[model samples]
Target: MSYITGFLTPVKTENKERYIESARKSWPLFQGYGATAQIENWGVDVPDGKVTSFPMAVKLEDGEAVVFSWLVWPDKKTADDAWARMQEDPAMANMDMPFDGKRMMWGGFETIFQN
Candidate 1:
């Protein structure tokens, strides 16, 4: 079974290119540390909710778009190890984020069903 790290981030609409480039730049870092793949999806038709929604969770603002991303790992141990090692990676430290990190939310998920 594979492990996954899911992420939700609100990036400024204008920074979409920068965001994609940032992800492209970081792919090697994650792959080097055991991530099998990285996927970043830019929201196309995300809707606002009255009570709670993707926008609400991230306190999305005008001129911003939501990014749904994930990293696929072989398993939990590999994922955990990669996370621990990434913190000390100099390249990661130097990587500039295109969005507000404080609003980003992430979690590790155990795949329940996959074909």
Candidate 2:
């Protein structure tokens, strides 16, 4: 099964370009560490909910948008190794995030199905 890491974050609407640039800069590290694929989705048609929703999940604020992203690895071992390496890589040590890290959410999953 493929290993996937998913991320949900709230980013300033005005920082979209900065965010994309950050992703572009970080892609090589992921590729070198065995990530097979990566996707970054900007929120469109996202709605606010009284109870819960994507926006609420990240505590979306004015002039902010939700970003859904994921990275796929060949297997858990490769993903694990990549994560460990990222922590030690100088390339990532000062990587600037265009959004608030405190509000970002992420997790790893073992993909059970894919087209």
Candidate 3:
């Protein structure tokens, strides 16, 4: 089964273009590292929650929007290895992060089911 690396980020609404560009620039690196696929989604109609929500989880600000993204890898080992090496790749090191790293959350998930 494939492995998944998911991300939830809070980015300035005005930086949407830069956000997409950053992802576009990073896609090749992920692919070179064995990622099979990648997806990036911009918030459209995300709602606020009374107790807990995507926005609340990231402490989203007034001018920021939440971005949901994921990358698919052949398996956990490939994903892990990719991540370890990606940290040292000069291309990755030089790519600009459009959003605040401190406000981003990510995790690797084992796929239980997928069509």
Alpha carbon lDDT of each predicted model: 0.95, 0.94, 0.94
Better of 2 and 3 by TM-score: 3
Name every residue pair that clashes in candidate 3: none
Q: How do the predictions measure up, each by TM-score?
A: 0.98, 0.96, 0.97
Ranking by TM-score: 1, 3, 2
- Please list all clashing residue pairs in model 2, or write none if there are none: none
Lowest summed-lDDT stretch of 10 residues in model 2?
Answer: 88-97
When 1 and 2 are scored with lDDT, the better candidate is 1
Q: Per-residue lDDT tens digits of candidate 1, residues 1-115?
A: 8999999999999999999999999999999999999999999988999989999988999999999999999999999999999999899999979998899999999998999
Candidate closest to the true structure, highest lDDT: 1
Q: Candidate 3, residues 1-115: lDDT per residue as tens digits?
A: 8999999999999999999999999999999999999999999888999999999988999999999999999999999999999888899889999998898999999999888
Check candidate 1 and list the clashing pairs: none
lDDT of candidate 3 at residue 99, scale 0 to 100: 94
Any runs in candidate 2 off by more than 4 Å, and if so which? none
